[model samples]
Structure formats: structure tokens, C-alpha cells
Target: MSINLSEPIKIVFNEIEIDDYLPSIKFKIDINIKQFTHLLTYSGEIWIDCKVWDRFSKGLNEGKDTTLNDMDDIFIIEIIKNNEFIEFTWSIKRKDPEGNVMTAGYSSKITDDVYSVIRNEFINYPKWW
Candidate 1:
């Protein structure tokens, strides 16, 4: 699949580009779209496993008529040193006339080898921008 971005964000770790949003994809978690945040330069909250939900961004869509929830494209995670240049990708979900997400994507790192749901319910651990 072709990758696209509304804003070409670069992953700048410690003032270096370790990876960009359009880099080698590891794996995409099947997290509900609603739980995502639009974090780009902020740190995230710590999960129960101590893994922190770091940052995120509104992703770029490649194909036309593609909504954020389509989940056909893989969301790229540009792991970097400096949080300011970390690359991320997401879709534009809900919006008002001015075009703003009622909610945004946040970072949540997988603490343990968790492959199942946590607490049997979806959680929205707030991320700071």
C-alpha cells in the first residue's frame, strides 16, 4: 500500500533521525481508532505496565474516500530520541466546522507481552501536549 502524510513529520532522536514515519514498519496494533491521540511533541501517561503512552499525530491518508477508521493502512511510528522530531501517522476522525478532533491520539507503549485486552475494557490514558 502507498503511504501518505498531511504533514511530513520526522523522527529526531537526540537531534538525529533514527526513523521517519515512512520507515520500516514493525507491527500495527488493532487498537480502536477512538482510543488514539494526535500527539506529536508531548510526553504521554504511564500505563499499568509502566510503559508510557508517549505521543501521536493525525495520520495521512493515501487513497481517496479513506476515513481514519479504515485501518487498511499501517500507522508508522518513528522512534526517535528527541520527542520534538518523532514521526507518527494517523487519520482525521471526527471534526467540527473548523475541523478538530473531539479527541486526539496519544502514545501507549506495550509494557509487557500483552496480546489481549487490558482490564477487559478500553482505556484512554491522557497524553500531554
Candidate 2:
């Protein structure tokens, strides 16, 4: 892959979640290009890609369901190329050794000069509630 030495790519903080939450839990993420997202271009240069996930637990069947816990969910993010697929995986190892999957991680193309805000999942504490 060849990169255009002439084109100066700059990163732009398009989205932010400094004061945000998932469900009721106080979740946060500092999404950045190069630092996180590592999309390789045809020029052999990496595009910006910083992906995040929801840490929400669901379908309660626990002995203690009084409060939502991050110790219960394993949210994730995934990435893929043109024909390849980016995938995120969810698993619960704390609750159960053979954890259950909640949802496929949300993934997107890594690119510079762009950013996004992802909601971290948390059960019980909803923005609505």
C-alpha cells in the first residue's frame, strides 16, 4: 500500500461522550484515530478507527439482580476489511464460566479525520428511567 505523502491528514474530534452513561452506569470512552482505529489504506497507511460497545446486561436470571454490574457483561467491538467483516462479541464470564453472548459488537471502518460516540450498555439505569 502506498500513501500520498502530499496529503496531510488531520484528526477531528467529531464526537464526544465526556458526560455519558449506558443505561444507568457511568460509562465513558476516548475515541481517537491511530490510537485505536487502525484501518490500513491501499497506500499501506492506517485509517482512523476507534470502536466501542454497550456494556449492558440483559435477560436477568441472576441470584443478585438488585444492581447492574459491569462484572457481568463482556461487550466488545470488531472490525473488517472490504470483503472481510468486522465483528464484536459479547460474553459473560463472571456470571457464568460458560458465559452467554449478548450482542454482536458494533464495528465500523477505521478512518482518519472522523470520530464517533458509542453508548456503553448498563442495565437498570436508563436515561428514560
Using TM-score as the measure, which candidate wins? 2
- Model 1: per-residue lDDT, tens digit, 1-129? 112212233211111121234232222222233333543442221111111112122111111111222122222233222323332233323445786544334343332122112211112323222
* Residue 23 alpha-carbon offset, candidate 2, angstroms: 20
Name the lDDT value of residue 9 in candidate 2.
25
The backbone clash count of each candidate, in order, is: 15, 15
The TM-score values for the models, in the order shown, are 0.19, 0.20
Q: What is the C-alpha RMSD of each candidate to the true structure, in Å?
A: 18.0, 17.6
lDDT of 2 at 4: 15
Candidate 1: 10-residue stretch with minimal lDDT? 57-66
The sequence of per-residue lDDT tens digits that candidate 2 reaches over residues 1-129 is 111111122212122222233322223222222324663221111112111112122221121112122323342222222334322221222234566533322234432222111111122223332
For model 1 the local lDDT of residue 81 reads 21
Candidate 1 has a TM-score of 0.19
The alpha-carbon deviation from the true structure for residue 97 of candidate 1, after best TM-score superposition, in angstroms, is 4.0
